[model samples]
Target: MTPVPPSRADRSSPGEVLRAGPLEIHATARQAFVNGARITLGSRAFDLLLMLAEAAGRVVSHDEIQARVWPNRHVSETNLRVQVSTLRRALGEARHVVSTVPDRGYAFTPFGQHAPEPDDAPVPGDHVVHVVDDEADMRDALEGLLMASGWRVRTYGSVGAFQEALTAQTAGCLILDVSLPGENGLELQRRLLALGLSLPIVFLSGRSNIPIAVEAMKAGAIEFLTKPAAGEDILAAVARAMALALSERPQSPA
Candidate 1:
């Protein structure tokens, strides 16, 4: 039998499988696996990861991200960061594999990992609460309290569903979960801004971490209530959100 030439066996292609820490990336296949389990990564993110991994260890500048990710079209750095955030969340335990250099571009550095957990509690009674939480028990608990207080409520488990609701009827306010399965709260907030939906947002978090709360407020949330907050506190937040929403609504021709 004839042996294959060294050139044929030594070449690497973009289709070759690449590894960054625990992640197994197949650029050609347009997919990735973590610890042997398939994980979801958006198309833009998939391309972003390929570019970063191809860098080996050198930082890829913001200009490079734009050229590669949005070539021939302009995109804001925020848009780029949103994709990075999604990529980081998808990376989960190995999120540190990607690094963000201060005042510089991101780089491919497979040197870290991360973890996750969940919690519970209740708050808020309102007009169309529009809860976007995947956790049913928590959603039900909030529903019970809000209904008991004579407040209307609507619940959704995904951003797509909530967006559908937004199209159907404007809500008084949105009670958003920071840890939604996809897009999450912050990402949703940005999307809402892009869509010109200024509906007041009230954030709910079980952890109630200060930094998280600060971020929520910074994103224009009417209030940031930790889980297990008093029924009255929830109602108070609802009132604030509703009032703000009402004020923002356009007046009918008189």
Candidate 2:
């Protein structure tokens, strides 16, 4: 039998708090705790947990899970499975709380349900990694790779597309292709500087042009790499960019 998707009331609002076994979930704050100790969860994992826990004891179908978690984005089964694995790992010994419901989907079985102790951990900011490449295949590949690594990702086909979607409040690093159809990566970098946007950029070029690479570095690019860069190298560059971006981000007032 097909499971019914949770309605608005059935879904947990960001302001609501949920407790199941040793898990204490703060939907509003986007946080979770086990046995009063806060646990680190990727953004997607946290969202999945809230959805399942809100619909506790009920099966959330694969379609519903993908829609709720990825929203308008189309993701592969592997993405969902990877996120589930990540969430389960974060749950530790209480991983059984999230159970696979045969071929239907998954359910949160409120095992050993109990009240949660008070917790006061500050919430961490959520960041996304943006990838801009003219090649559709490249964009998809990079998105999957980064998402699998637990980083939220957004991809664009060109500088115009990226600029259209960018805003002052946008956070995270950018993986940019050097030779774009319009504006090009270096031009965009210059424009961003003129506009005072401090988004960290990691440039990828099909050709190894020393002059262009040096210019990008002088303009404050976190890393510049020739195309077909190793996955480990890309990941490392992104990690450094994220660290720089987060450090520059203004902290919220207490």
Candidate 3:
């Protein structure tokens, strides 16, 4: 494991401001400016910039970046890369200030600059969505829909497969079908609760099973939809689930 750096609050005063060429970062206010004009940056992008800027000339490893920007979430390298690209775009001409160190991580070179872009910045997705359904067609369809709507999606054909892939740090929403060959969706939900994993879930059933739906909702499922659910409805449910997941993330220390 890469050694974790000191918290940002530990190294800087509340109102401290950092400068990199023409860019200015207001730490307390969590805002950035370029040439005296404010720029639009997403929360994650801003966090990434702050971490890199504070570290300045040091190479902040991928692990450190993920720990600071995502806190407890288990995010892929692609997520970090995307945020870096976002930060670079926000920085405009000064984008070269943020450089990727080969096989290591990223660094904020205040003096030097480079022009290597991140490889094929994956679809502009914010979070991963894990889909578990026994039907191959359903899994593929959901994956396509979610990916098209800017979500990183992974599909599994069985509960076992999903469980095998899951870890304590897995951070995302789950779209699970209620029926399976064994260890059904409801059982998996119960097991997850017992294991203390609070991953927000959206339940899908081929038939409208009111009792199962009630059970799932009672157990804290974000949404329970019966197929053939409309595409819009599924997307809406996923959005809600993603929101819930975001809300449940542990906040970083101030």
> Pick by TM-score: which candidate is best?
2
Query: Against the true structure, what is each candidate's TM-score?
Result: 0.48, 0.52, 0.51
Q: In model 1, which range of ten residues has the least summed lDDT? A: 1-10
Clashing pairs in 2: 14-28
TM-score result, candidate 2: 0.52
Q: Estimate candidate 1's alpha-carbon lDDT, on a 0 to 1 scale.
A: 0.69
Question: What is the Å distance of residue 53 in model 2 from its true position?
Answer: 50
- Per-residue lDDT of 66-146 in model 2, one digit per residue for the tens? 889888888665456445644665787566577654346778766643212113222235578899999999899889889
lDDT of 1 at 10: 19
Residue 28's lDDT in candidate 2: 83
Candidate RMSDs in Å, in order, are 16.0, 18.5, 15.1
Cα deviation at 62, candidate 1, in Å, is: 39
Off by over 4 Å in 2: 1-126
| Count of backbone collisions in candidate 1 | 3
